[model samples]
Target chain A: MSLKPTPVSRASPNRAGATLDAFLRWREASIIVVAILLTIYFQAVNENFLTSANLETVSQFIAASAIIACGEVMLLICGEIDLSVGQVFALAPFLMHFGTNAGLPIIVAILLALVACGLIGAINGFITVKLRVPSFVTTLGTLYILNGVTLTLSHGSPVETGGSEAMGNFLGASPYAEILWAFAAVAVMHYVLRQTRWGLHTIATGGNLIGAAEAGINVARIKIGNFVLTSVLGGLTGILEAHRIGSIDPLAGGTTVMFLAVAAGVIGGTPLAGGSGTIIGALVGAIVLGVLRDGFTLQGINAYTFDIIIGAAILLAMISNIHLGRLRRGGGR
Target chain B: MASALRADNIVKRFGSVTALDGVSMHVEPGEILGILGDNGAGKSTLMKILTGYQSPTSGTLQVHGQDVVLRSVDHARSLGIECVYQDLALVGGLSVAHNMFLNREKLRRFPPGMLDNGEMRRRARQVLEDIGVNIPSVDLEVERLSGGQRQAIAVARAVSSDARILLLDEPLAAMGAREAALIIDLVLRLKARGNLSIIMIMHNYGQTLDIADRIMLMQRGTVTYEKAAAETSVPELMDIVRREYRAVRSA
Candidate 1:
């Protein structure tokens, strides 16, 4: 009468099929299958798709988006979003540059830049939470403000990334460095979301704000902390990109990257409506997007056509995810 | 024994509008007290003050014979006061065990900040079992459960925290007869434990009489009537309410 599973599981005597059904019922399962199929198709389309060099190139694309998606997924699950994170991404390397100009060491400059980004996130959080402005509008305003600040500081010109070659390689110049950072971010965030109280509170905050508050979960702090995390991660991704390209462009990242990160999260099964999300699922989504971009580029698809196809792919993924989500919510009975 | 809770001449005002006006009530230890009222009768305001969701403009509250002013919901909980709201206060996306532990999660020592999910699940199961809640599994998200089950979980959470005073705001509202019966049984079970003092703000007359040991009726921000539930009938309550309605209309 208590603590037992529903009759559905007992009625099915085939254990293996039941296990497989459960696996498929997971939110990440569909995306993982999609990523695998894309990988095989790309490899078949072009021999170079699986080549180590080409794989590294594809990973570079996944790296930035996946890292940002990790933080965005957390924010989304908590019912907030940071549109200015991409702008913060464009701002970090320049802040680091100014730090070095002020006689700070490279590492110190990088840390300072990240700290500054965290402050920006706090501002975003305060304005959204305390001022009662919607987060989207708040971040949108910061997005423009950050962009203008970066452009004015750089005089609208690109600058060579100032750190030593060794530092550069450590950040993102090496083929695997950026991807490694992304993977690390994913692993730590996955643990946080699944194993820590902070993550559980974040989910609860999004699930039902009044309910979370009634339970004494400190909903505001959870939202503010996630905002800070998203900004810092965004800054880190920007710095990595600057080092990888050996130059910092005032226009790098901006809206395109933010949208891609958000798209990855949604495709990974984190709903825009909030309350639930999966970090590993975001990584798989990033992989799917990366495979499409790099694979099409390898097959010589034009950039314009690629955008159209990517747009269509995102739509298809979202529609399928919505249906799959029904199965998930049905408890797989 | 001292009453488990006592509110002395409580008054609450929202700007120029008075919500609760010089109302006083008390509930004996191990007793189920039902507060009945219509909409805008200050029932919610009084419940809010009791749960420390809001402060009274003028009043004194005594819990276990100790005079106190509750500062916030958490402060009230620290004094062993817990509320199961009409909304149930359960996260739809969270598992039953997760919702039960919520802010007070059990943590593993070695990992420093990681949740001790296994321990939480065990304790949640024990608590639910002890309270006689027939949850299918603690791992199921609360949204998957029926309204009665969700209400039961909310009560289980309150009891698990050792709440000496339990407040339920419209626990049976919008529920079917069977669902309401489930909660009624659960409430009776808690009362039978002989420790918790229960206060339910309700709109249903017959149901309140069936469950509460004593009942108080509120009208226009004041206590209009009070009596033992065993001595009150549905028609008697309806006549009183109708008289009050007529008086308001004539005035």
Candidate 2:
């Protein structure tokens, strides 16, 4: 489709304001505004919601999820999904913990974790692409294997994730400063997805893998790269959490955060079917959910109720975003 | 001129199904070959094997006098054998410039390992302009573009890759009259470039008659007839298609 849809009702190009207004009414921006307004309103209602301490806590909580979600967004955009993210996330940190405990330097441990996660991603991609297995099922299998590995290694107990004081210093200022890291990470990934050939291919793959391959996109590489991004983010999160909590729990680095990350992505307007959405929207979605969680907790909501609220919010975001996505695709049946 | 591509006795079977059996064809330099067949006539399978999307069980493929194994799509592309599948594979979420140069992005050094976007957008615009693909904006996502525009960009992108042989599978399948005409025009312009050999598989006989120098008919994984474009009529071609399909069904 070569033509950008201009409202046929208006003819004159002389009126810049009308065109600008139409542009501003883009669906992505509208949902983001709604998310922001809800956050601000809740913050107003509960003073604790606006406090530096809670914001710091939420920042740390959302940072890892946000990071993992970036990779998920890229993968999903290509019409593929990485269910192995939660597992790969755990796998990387586990590698670092086991390696670092045995005597490798912290930098080396972190590098190993990053590299291992990347390889795991590559393997997952290879299996999916080569075998022609649906990424969903392949990643799901990897997810189970990873989870089993984490459980077996940790014996269902926390692993001491210690080796580098320098690494600890690099991940935080009580985690809010971690937001700076998250922002920078998001920016870098955003640039990659938007500006680079790899980034374009990832989007293209998500949009139409057939078309992407025809256009010379190494769709498998894009998928592998995305898988690595998702896992690396999760591992980085694990690395950060290990540093933050001063220990790593197998279940603590689990699929719930991965689910939440994806939910935040969908809520932020990244379509589940792929080839749409932005890193910025995902970031905003992460923050919006973080704020919503904080606001509810400050209002003295019960823990179970909070889960119910989050689950509902995730469902709402999925339905609304999906419906809007359909409209954007010219209301497909 | 010598033939640019030759497929000799290509045989591909999927278990009980013989997708392409003893199929053969050749494309001389700068020739436009049209292939016609009904659904499941091995059009895609033969093309797939030729373009390295699939490997034939027994066959010889020669490009520029070298018998090459069509191993992977990337490998095929590297050899300057390009394929445009019927799906018109375009990522709907990307911008026109981005789509026009999806994998082959023009990257400029930003800072050390970083990249420059300003250059990529500029290159995209330049390519689109060169190919005469008119999009309202390079920044607008492809979903916003019309069907014709998308096809134009897809064709333009394929031709831009400096491909010596372009295999287009059903490029006009689902296009309206106006869209189809423009694409046909694009094909003629590409043919005029003189270094490119084109093999287009199409259902629309009229359009194929208009552009192709020669036509080949296949039925049930085998070539049944071949004729120069000027030598065949629509009714004759239709009879050949029907006759081939009947023979295959009875066999």
Candidate 3:
């Protein structure tokens, strides 16, 4: 007996410019197009835009945000968000600094710092899942609490992270080192989100919580795991930045970076509503923000105007994402 | 014939209200037991208890004559009991193959937790084909499929999971005639296998008479009638429902 394959009704139209039309139809593909176009436009507009030094600076600026965004993408896909990641990002390095100052081994201090962040994540998960509080409210409260702790510990002052030279070299010897960490995070997380049972479960939990539970999936565990993952990545980003800069600034990585990371994830292709997301899209989103900021600076654009442009760009990307999503669903209105 | 499942004197209470009162039933291997009831007749509650979604407030459940304690949905599934719920419980954004695998995903040999996507897709295709569901692609997200197709996938998921006993809650509700016929055919084919038992909750008495070997009717948390389909008539079932409605109204 011959089994015939059924043809997909909504296959892309076989017409002129089909490749371009297909690219325009997909959210991730369109974002890549915009990123490439922005890069070319910036390079053409400024003589120093494409220089290795400027490119390195751009990468350094994006590295920490990209790492945080990778984690946020997972949390968002799982139907939660962490406003406290920025506070955790700022506080982790301070913990590491104090630990090393107290004669603890550098590696031990880093682990201790990560453990502290993980604890915060667990608290966030506990409140959100077990206590029945919305994650938005729980993370908001933690954000304030963690920020206050960082400020009180540092006396609102910058402190030097007097780590061993070897630790510093391994963590933040060059600007490229931070980029490597970011890419490594992207690769690992991308694989986990796409190729693993945990990843599928996360998507299922976020997609339909009750359905996942009925399917015998431990929804609570998936949510808690994602929260811990997000916090740990934020903590790692903090530790890397402190090692590179050689100092812990209590005000560094404030809520601004948290918002930027979320924006980057959404812009890259992950919906804020949960159920669907991508890590590579988030990486590109960070790069897009980086290119925009670097380009604006090179063009001598005003800082306030840059903020407005970024905000507008985010809104535009979101609208396009929604529209394209509808288009894919048989062009439903 | 050996009984596949037996629920004896099950009682369930939700705080101040009793949802089920001493409900007892048995399903034989290869037999389709049709449960007919009104909106709040405790059919769904009984099904939930049987599938381990909710434990009975008091009672015992037996599988293949062995007394068992159902701790969770997974526990029930381990005992070879599966339920296809009315809500369908499908993740709309996931591909058909992904939904088929859901919590029971197959993993790659080397990487451990990594999903074996190629194998799952192949198996999902084969399963759907065996069930004779005409789906365009297993790669399509379930939300993209028509209503009948969605129902087919949900039923197919339960059928292909090595279930010895299947509980279907309103499996044909809100489906078109063609779609309903398709599900009926699948159910009959599974019955022919002789290794599985089915308990179907239905609102339509005629369809139940067409497919069920035995019919059980419930009204207001109690079993009001039970009879072999061959001996019972639709008029008799309606008379039982009318009498129950009168009793409910008088009380």
What is each candidate's DockQ, to 2 decimals? 0.60, 0.45, 0.53
User: Model 3's CAPRI class?
Assistant: medium
Model 1, range B141-243, lDDT digits (tens) per residue? 8877777788889999989997999999999999998788888988999998888999999998999999999999999899999999989899999999999
- Candidate 3 lDDT at A102 equals 87
Consecutive 10-residue window with the lowest summed lDDT within model 2 chain A: A1-10
Q: lDDT for model 2, please.
A: 0.77
- Which is the better candidate, 2 or 3, if ranked by TM-score? 3
Instruction: Supply the TM-score of chain A against the true chain A for every candidate structure.
Output: 0.96, 0.88, 0.93
Clash pairs detected, candidate 3: none
TM-score of 2: 0.87
lDDT of 1 by residue, A78-130 (tens): 99998999999999999998998899999999999999999999999999999
TM-score of each: 0.97, 0.87, 0.96
- Candidate that scores best on lDDT: 1
True contacts kept of 2: 0.59
Q: Given the true complex, what DockQ would model 1 score?
A: 0.60
Query: Taking the tens digit of each residue's C-alpha lDDT, what string does model 3 give over A1-333?
Result: 122233433444677556656666565886888899999999998989999999999998889889999889999999999999999999999998888888999899999999989999999999999999999999999999999999999999998878678778678757589999999999999999989999999999999989999999999999998999999999999888888898889998978889889988988989999999889999999999999999999999988988998898899889888887777655211
Q: Quote the lDDT for B59 in model 1.
A: 92
Candidate 1 runs further than 4 Å off = A1-13
